[model samples]
Target: MSAREPLIVQREVKPLDFLAAGETASEFKELLKSLGIPTDICRRASIVTYEAEMNTVIHGGGGVMSLRLEDDAIIIVAEDQGPGIADLEKAMQEGYSTAPDFVREMGFGAGMGLPNIKKYSDKLEIDTRVGEGTTLRAYIFIKGQREE
Candidate 1:
């Protein structure tokens, strides 16, 4: 006998969600908790999801965030249809942002999104095209959590 696995959960990130992106993170936190994911992994996943969701709202035009729980890891995929990152290397830098003044005024887009996402996730994959779109895949394993 084995414990039941959690079902896949997907949420659409509309431009409007930008006004309340924090809610997105909250939603994931609650869902992961309900699914019995380890606290550390859930925290990491929440951070990555929030960052990725913000990127979609601020840059990706619009996208979808999907989550799945595996026996050993949590998988998150954020896909958006918007202008892709021109320079992946440059974009990966912390505190580097291309957000306009309005977005900046909204207290988002401080350029820490990608860097933070990479920092917390065990594995990450980013796919983008200049004019096509972008897809980010992040994984957090459920073992060896560190104390805060």
Candidate 2:
């Protein structure tokens, strides 16, 4: 195995189904804790995961978000269908949101989702195609330790 390979543990959840508003963040935090992840890291991971899950529900009409806990990193993969991002750069910018009026009324369309995920993660990769779908893979590294 390569040094860069992640020893991954994966979990897949249907958008809005497995993660409802009141339980998503807490469930994720618990999962991280069960895996021996630190509290601070769990908080960041939960935030990022929740944002991605909401995006999948609101924009993609529901999809799957996979969480992977590796030896030295945490990886989150969110995949969704149709209405791929038109401008990734613009989407990554804070406060640039295309959320519907309803979502905006719900006070969640500040366009900080992607930017926040990128901010808290060590690496973020987004794959999207117009009229098709999008896939976002993010990695958060464990501090002060290198995994072989």
Q: Could you list the CA RMSD of all candidates, in the order they appear?
A: 4.3, 4.6
Distance from true position, residue 34, model 1, in Å? 1.4
Tens digit of lDDT per residue, candidate 2, span 107-142?
777899899988877889888999898888888887
List the candidate 1 regions with Cα displacement exceeding 4 Å: 1-7, 146-148
True-structure RMSD for candidate 2:
4.6
TM-score, predicted candidate 1 vs. hidden true structure = 0.89
TM-score of each: 0.89, 0.83
Q: Cα lDDT of model 2 overall? A: 0.75
User: lDDT tens string, model 1, 34-113?
Assistant: 88877777788888888988999889888888787777878778888899999999999999999888999978889999
Residue 137 displacement in candidate 1 (angstroms): 0.4
lDDT of each: 0.83, 0.75
lDDT of 1 at 113: 93
